[model samples]
Target chain A: MALSHDEVLHLAKLSKLTLSSEEVLHFADQLTPVVDYFRELNEIDTSNVPETSQTTGLVDVLRTDEVDASWVLSQEEALSQALKTHNGYFVVPAIFTRTS
Target chain B: MNIPLSISEVQNDLVQKKYSCVNLVEHYLSEINTQNKTLNAFLTVTDEYAYTKAKELDRVITDNPHAIKEFPLLGMVVSIKDIYLTKGIRTTAASKVLESFVPQYSSTVVERLESAGAIIIGKTNCDAWAHGASGENSDFGATKNPWNTEFVPGGSSSGSAVSVASGLSFASMGTDTGGSIRLPASFTNVVGFKPTYGVVPRYGVISMASSLDSMGHFTKTVEDSEKIFAVTRGVDGRDSTVVNHSYKAVSPTQKFRIGMPKEYFAKGLSPEIEQKVRAAAQEFEKMGIELVEVSLPHTKYAISVYYIVQPAEVSSNLGRFDGIRFGNNRDSFGEEAKRRIMLGTYVLSSGYYDAYYGKAMKVRSLVIKDFDDAFSSVDAILAPVSPSLPFKIGEKSDDPLQMYLADIYTVAANLAGIPGLALPAGFSESGLPIGFQLLGKRFSEPTLFELGKKYQAVTDWHTKKPS
Candidate 1:
């Protein structure tokens, strides 16, 4: 499936990336052949094989029973990592300048 | 003895207090200071902690020497792959995206190795996110081969293998999804071991193809690899993929049976490498081992199957790497990574998932069945780790398809979830190292180690200097 320009933009947003218009066009070209290679996987036959949820033929990985505790970091500590924070959380520019 | 600088010579020195743990730490760190610039093997060097730990160990040795005796890796230095979490230290996976990120916890393997008495030298470089077989894919500058200045040290475990090969550290931890460990080891004339799938825990490791990603080791010798595995193998509650199986402790039986796959011996294999592999086979025969020709009828399609399955997993595994989680912003991520993500996404998307990921998984089953059949009649399978000797750095770097095929010989083991060991075969006439591997049954590493140690004992292939 050739990636649509809008789909690429959506994926980039989902991936937390912001691509310029020219860069998007260039990336679209580079992503074309790679997508074509994966398209070949559609020809494979998996009907007889059990769906592999995970390798190691394993299921039901249980979490550790032991509970460990750690010193808590305050909101001040959490917000220390950001260049901009509002209240106690990191803040970023709106996804869009304004809602239409 | 200067406290026995190399791992092979250090057991006795460490056993006695003549060299003291403090002295050995200083010795290796000093060597690294002078030698690391030329090798470019480490991304960080943990000198302060190493010295402090060494001094503390000295007090422990004085108070209770017996306690320290249980530790086999005492006073050893280990270089960690950048992908594993090393709480408080950066773990970037060679991508620009997580430059400032540090994990809140340590990886299980790192904790185990530290408890075993090995001091971490620092995190090392890899192909970005363990994506490629060559270190060139790194967001960090490429790691040059230690042997020759102009060649690449294979990747995505590039710095790890180069560190051990050039003696920047005693050994290094590397992850192998598809020849990432062995490819670089072969290039540098070191021993790179991929434990049987599920043998080592992968929790806290930056996952790459969760089904195939294996936490492995890079060492200067096969014996050292055995020691590393003995300490690192076990069940971890963190990685659900880890198997509960333990390898047989015994070595190969008398009249060992080794098989060569006809598929791996076909065209595109260099005449020199073919000759080297043949000689190595003959040497095994001289050791009273049996060499038989085997057919893995499905081998021809192993690469095709691997590309489909791996990229499909890459699509899912890498979904978290949007600019927010890890990895660079769209612009900072290298071209190769973007290419893989796009390809993977396309294959797993609607109308294509069944065709690609589904078919690849089916073919994977056939490949595993092929190994099961072959191993029933043979002790282990031997083949060239790579079809050709190391090529010049830029020769195949630009050609993605040709570069992907470089892993053709090594990917089957990953596809089948088996263990493979890459050891130096011989050198090309041009002085580059060539390597061959012995693929063993799941959890049958002792067999490969025994064979590798014996071969290394007779030939100095493992000892030759690139210079």
Candidate 2:
């Protein structure tokens, strides 16, 4: 179960995190022991047991289709925290660039 | 004159005109100013906001003295762990990613606490994303344990415990995903109570493990913890997981059956901590209570299950911090946060989902069932909050597994979605405080409170404060 370097990079990408080369090497060192230690779970027989996904026992609590005026964050307030804004809209990196 | 005061004492003093609310707040402010530099307990102090709120409370109290009854926490000061979102206030969650992120809205808990007339003086430091057991994981800086500056404050609710322990605030709110609240409470010699899951709404709290996280608080005394729990526990529409469980006040049983989990005392536990916990449990025998040796066989696997399940949820929960939303890019995550996210990503990945995430979930059921079986035979479970006393600052920081092992006795309560209270049991030989945990069935917080208050009645350990 030791993670390869490429696999670690893939995970970092999937996690939307960009790790430095040193961090990649560091995480590679750290995650191996952690993942290897997690092998303790293999010793236990949990063949037919059900998974405890949500423990609260409440299921699909549907609220009424109405707006609470107080809970709503105003447009100005919502956009206030953004580091970059343009024309009252949050500015983000372009998903697509015409580099070709 | 500057001695530690419980929340009730401060409230009573405010009502009796012993001091004005503004002066009381100023007193705490001055204490924070003096101690925060050394303790590093606070991340952001809302001095202007606290003063304004206190002045308003003073005016109201002057106009009509009995008006204080309307606000249970009238003019009382409290601090919040940075994990809670504070409106218009910079909440870092002790991560560089949200270092300058000022939340647009406050959490429901913050709203409730503020409206109840409690003045929020500051947001305290915690481990980044509530990821580490030691406060060293905080991106801002590690919070020092108030009892001894050189020792690390147990975390990720590290500063909350220190703030309360040092009398900077009457009480402080913290979220316990595993042992965040209790362990710090134990280490700092304060009462930390984690109510049954979903009892307190988690609407605006920065979530670590959604399913396991319980919003709780640290207080000078168990009675204060009970009072705060009464004010904050309820259902919120924003958090769909909240259950409408009514809080029924329970009294300490004269002939109660308290369980001492045999596995909890087995190995890796400090003999000193064991002796302190056992001495506290024996007090029940003196009160005509039966102490049964119960076994939670699946307890050994809790830390493994927690790390797996928690990181999986963290990976999903932290996805919102993608730079485009509000904070910096995910690249700003600390080593611990990155490790958790990557581990989560690996577990939930295509080929490994069933082996890792799925298997952990099934074992989680076994852990929950172990608690269910144990509770059927005993009214509550008593155990040590940590394996050993609070070590020096850098003792466990190097080895992550060693740090995770510190949560062995505390995580099962989170996994089972039950109420657990950490009460000051005794002091170590070197005078560091130790706390024993009282765990009850789901929604049995009042029972735990009853026992906690009862314990505090006979012992003065909760009254001892750091120099």
DockQ of each: 0.32, 0.80
Model 2: lDDT equals 0.88
* Lowest summed lDDT window (length 10), candidate 2 chain B: B246-255
lDDT values for all models: 0.77, 0.88
Question: Which candidate wins on TM-score?
Answer: 2
Q: Write the per-residue lDDT of candidate 1 for residues B1-467, one digit (tens) a residue.
A: 24332464675665565687667667667867876787666777777877777776667666765744666676677889999988667788888766666666788899888887787878888888887877888877788787786888888899998887777777899999989998999988889999888879998898888888888998878888888888888887667777677566663455689999999999989999888888888889998889999988777667777777777777677766544433344566666676666556655677767776667677778788889999999989999988877766788766676788888889889888888999888888888888889998887788888998888888887766545
Candidate 1 structure quality by residue, lDDT tens digits, A1-100: 5667886776556444567787577667656554565444345455676644344776676875775455344566555445566777666546767658
Off by over 4 Å in 1: A1-54, A64-66, A70-100, B1-8, B251-253, B322-331
State in Å the error of residue B414, model 1.
Answer: 0.7
Off by over 4 Å in 2: B251-254
Clashing residue pairs, candidate 1? A41-B355, A41-B356, A42-B355, A42-B356, A44-B359, A45-B359, B97-B327
Alpha carbon lDDT at B298, candidate 2: 90
| Per-residue lDDT of B466 in model 2 | 94
Chain B: TM-scores of all predictions: 0.95, 0.98
